[model samples]
Target: MAPPFAGGEEDEEARWCGLSTDMMEMILKHLPIADHISVSIACKSWRLATSDIILPALRAPWLLGSPMASTSLSWGFYTSSNGGQSLGLEIPTEFQRQWCCGSSKGWLMHLREPRNHSQYYEAHLLNPITGATVELPPFPPTVIKGVISTSPFATDFMLAALCFESTNFDKYVIVYQPRHPRRKKILIDNAMDIMFHHGRLYILTDLAELLVGVFDPRWKVSFKSIPTLFEEEGRHPDTYWGKLVESNDGVFVVYCTITTGAERQQLKVFKIKEWGRHHRIVEVKSLGDRTFFVGPFSDGVSISKMKSSSKLNIIKPDHIYYITGSEYSLWAHCMQKRHTFRVEEFKMTGNILEWFIPKLEDRSNLMVVTPTHSTSLLLTIIIVMLAVIGQCLLGWLSI
Candidate 1:
């Protein structure tokens, strides 16, 4: 009788199965976020190796549109780089009916229906890539505007929501995950937008002053004011929209001006610099290699080193992609080139357009595998080869 490992085929199989866990992990880290879950289920050793591996950032932001009224399984996505290629994704039925309120850190905050129709609906954070959901406390039925969090995966996270009561013209900012039963609330008369950055919460008011709130060790909130560079521009407040963004350098406040009937729009960016004890706003004439994507619901910006690469068509550095309030039309304004282009291929009608970033979570599709599976090894090898080819193509195009 032949030995169990005598054949060349068996030897080859054993060699592949004997790959070190660390080696497997290093290889998997280079793959995209979408392939993480699929590769984790390949085999026992591969599954254990990728259990804690971090994924690389592969693609830029894709515009996620609302599902069509006819089909609950399909959602639309537009790639800005590929000349606005329209792609449809099949999502779960539960997400089809819900309304997307906000998105951050690769998670979408949706207003889901209540278990019982009599009860009030609650908001839940869903990672559309991994199908993981985190339930949040119930919110009021009024127009809840803001939802920003430091990170959804962290143990100690700060979440803030701005609820607007149109009847009484009251606006309240609710800070969540408090020790006591009642969360902290701050009342502002005309707070327009709220953003959280670097352990501080910023509120942009109608007076063009940035309100800075810092939570103490005991979670008590204190407020201060920072002078803005917009005051020096002498532009009308009604013509511009302000948003807070974090970049590689530091925090920046961007003001985008789009008049009702004007043909040209302007974007003014300021960097928040700290002196001895005061925060000074410095105006920047160029964005370098960073592009800002601003929307009504959520605002996000992306930075890329390969500005002239054909693969990076969806987003270019030193540009701004903004959505109009009434028409919901998407437009890209190049800061350096001083030109404007419309992303009319998507044609979003309603106020549901949002920028979505992709991420992979380990808790969702992790499963124990056994060594009896040999087919999984083939699939993993194929996937790894494809990923390598894709990366090479991207690098070649970048040159």
Candidate 2:
């Protein structure tokens, strides 16, 4: 009976399954990382091909047109991975003169200039991912204190917040501001600017008060002011734009105080752990006119310190770029080293620099400052123990 249909016959049957390698590749492309790993172990062919697949391309789509699209105002480009020079996409001429903020899902928010000083401001929302561009609704009419800033840093959501006072209360409310720049000009005041933390939104006002707002997906915004730690100093001398940064855990409140007849900018990082609120403040050299905390938090939680010197911004966690400034040099506090990128710094120039560093964007690639082999072994043991407890739940589910 043809040797009981064994060996060659079985091979023929497997071949008749008609699974083309090309079809397998296509199927594996859409699977999540965990599923991909699971599938590779099913057979030898998939194991070889899946191991060779490039992972980053599987990430969500983003804008990669031009970093220098604006003729009127220069723009900077940033991503979690090392952004290739070829990936830079230029903004269309229509968006050249206007202020634009780009979100994680490739949403571009631009403010169209008004015809007259008193004319209403116009804004548009363009999703580069879906290529859906539409005008936004008008925001609450208040004199928005400052311009909108967009962070390339990846978070749960791309956010925008504004700070304003209600005429009734001397206190200001930081609104969960949307990415509507034109509405900002019409409805919002200059006291507001966008700030994000641990996927939360905050309104940072000119008074140095941070009003954190929590909102639902329905666009119903609510405001809660983060009371200052300053001990009754009568409204702690106006904190500036460059002073606020979100750390690995919470937010770092930075402000320059005149102590003992010298200007000292105290970098105080606030972390909320199981033990409650904790503060870590350090006296560092040359607090950039503006610096963004980008990682390698001393703990398992990583934190990045991004500081600006001139047009060149030293974004910590690697992938440095000259986004805005006349000079390419930066006084990096982490490395405690000065770096210059030559003429590239002039590509985008300014001091009123405001932009977002997408949170944990390039986190994995960051050079973590870790301890020696002995300490690493200890950490590994702790991690393994934690993993055991975590996997136990999965094992129980299978039963």
Candidate 3:
């Protein structure tokens, strides 16, 4: 692509500047993430196209400050896209004093003690990269971790979590839905992890059971036990760590196990397939274009079906980045090839590290600009004004 001011005929100029936004997006879709800035600089139309195409693309998750780096105040994270580089971001001063209890997909859930005389703590979702926050209702101290459904500013925003404040098997899952004055609770017990998938809440329990929660006119969570893989197949329960992840193939429970070796390269992955009451755990070799990130502090987030053009090439396809309960280190492993990359020095508080995806700047607050070119639109406007002036002069002279 030549510079915008390169010598060109009218036809060449038209060809470069006349492309419609849709056509520009089609071309930009094929280009790598690195070429987007160049395309955006080519012309106003391409800049519009770049904003349309890139805003919704998959963003790389941030490696939240290891727990050791975190004190009671002020949290930090690494972008990890630039081979572990820093992106300037601000964690609100108030949040610095709060606890970051939950994090996922560009949002962090913080719990703060009430400034007023209230019994319950206040919880809210904060997007550090965007400096936007959604005010949440007061929550009891029993709340553990939270998962935000979408952007906190979105119309359909919802928050769900596993709580300890409730009695066992009763109201263990708490949900804060849009347009609701108070939160809702679900009845489930021993929930190890909670995830929202296909418009339903899935809870994994310590006993290798699944609780599917549906919020219809009322909240109902159905339970199922799938232990044939561990009980019948003789796979030791202590040998693996499990979490639920969504894929193009559907939701599956990923059981990851680290084998004993000097290289520590062996990582096995398996999925659970259920039909009525019969459930079979199947070995999975590949995760396709999907990638999963799991840690002790947040729900397993699978950022899947990504475009090849994203700067997040560091996140390998079909690979899972996991942290076992006993191990504080992070490991990225491929199911089929068993290729592994381990980084062991991340000393987080309680050895916990949460994955965070940074949100773009608040679009509602950004100043929108109308594109104008001095050699194009501006010149045309000047010519039209000059013509109007000439016509008025001729009429005045005749009068």
Candidate 4:
């Protein structure tokens, strides 16, 4: 195809360079961080536009390639940015073989059974980019799901997992901090799904009952119960799926219940609101600008905060991509089009296919600025300048 605008090469160049700074910045917002960084070096105006904009959390997650793919044994090496395409990844060979159970805040749960304890599995918090591994505490082998508060690269972050305790199948949620010697345990018999939102852990119980767990600075937690969303069906579990999804508005508890009939499975979504003593959940009519994806395990992601150029364009908004009925039985609930259909291409039957997202920014460029380092560095620079000035004065006086 030929170019749409017809002009001399010089004239076309001038037209692009003439765009105002605000307009240039607006255009750059639709591009990925790396792509915009590349555009910055093109000219002065483009550089000025991109310099001040804060780098955001790229929302579209990378779908781990099918375990059966032929690429590098495809264990964890290959990735599909969009559902249809494949890309080669340089993940470490050790990580390539581990079972990827869950992902949160751009970190994957890499678990391996070395000694094979009936209760726990040996695991490492993997940094795929550098292949740097942090030895993590023993994690439950039978985990329902887990999440990390922030990048483990930071000094303080928490890993929370909900799993059965032992052979009797007692439900327990364990919280692990990096430097802490012991893990904190919360025994909630009927808890369905858990989410860490706004510094508080929200535990979803039977029939959409909300339990908010408030954590202290020391990691001690206290629970506050919120009112139920709807009338109770019975003591039996009504929530087939309950996940805390981030929307454009805020973090919301999205719970789904399946219809009792056998012909086709129907799913309902509900959003929670806070009231004086009793928080409330309203049935969600549509997903506003959020694509919620849930796999067979306990991981669900709201893919909303993304750039257009980011390969995550494969995930569409107002849609829910989930595996129900069976592992291979994948369905997409498209609310905008009011349509639901089976997604056949994504069907993976044999090996586990968990959604993996590592932070895109190079770690060396990232910094955590606290009073501890910044203040000391400032003092050191001042001291060096003062010493140089003193030495110069002495030399001049001696001369």
TM-score of each: 0.75, 0.43, 0.66, 0.67
Give the CA lDDT, 0 to 100, for residue 190 in model 1. Answer: 72
lDDT of 4 by residue, 30-51 (tens): 5443344344444454445555
lDDT per residue (tens digit) for residues 53-139 in model 1: 644233456667764444443455554444444544434677767767676666777776667774456877777665677777776
Clash number for candidate 1: 3
Q: After superposition, how far is residue 27 of candidate 1 from its true place, in Å?
A: 12
| RMSD per model, one decimal | 6.5, 15.7, 11.1, 14.6
| Candidate 3 Cα misplacement greater than 4 A, ranges | 1-49, 52-59, 66-72, 116-119, 153-156, 165-171, 218-236, 257-281, 304-314, 324-328, 339-341, 344-352, 359-399
Q: For model 3, what is the alpha-carbon lDDT of residue 124?
A: 83
- Candidate 3, 95-118: lDDT as tens digits: 877878887556888888888978
The candidate 4 region of ten consecutive residues with least summed lDDT is 365-374
lDDT of 4: 0.59
| Cα lDDT listed for each candidate | 0.64, 0.37, 0.61, 0.59
Better of 1 and 2 by lDDT: 1
Which of 3 and 4 is the better model by lDDT?
3
Better of 2 and 3 by lDDT: 3
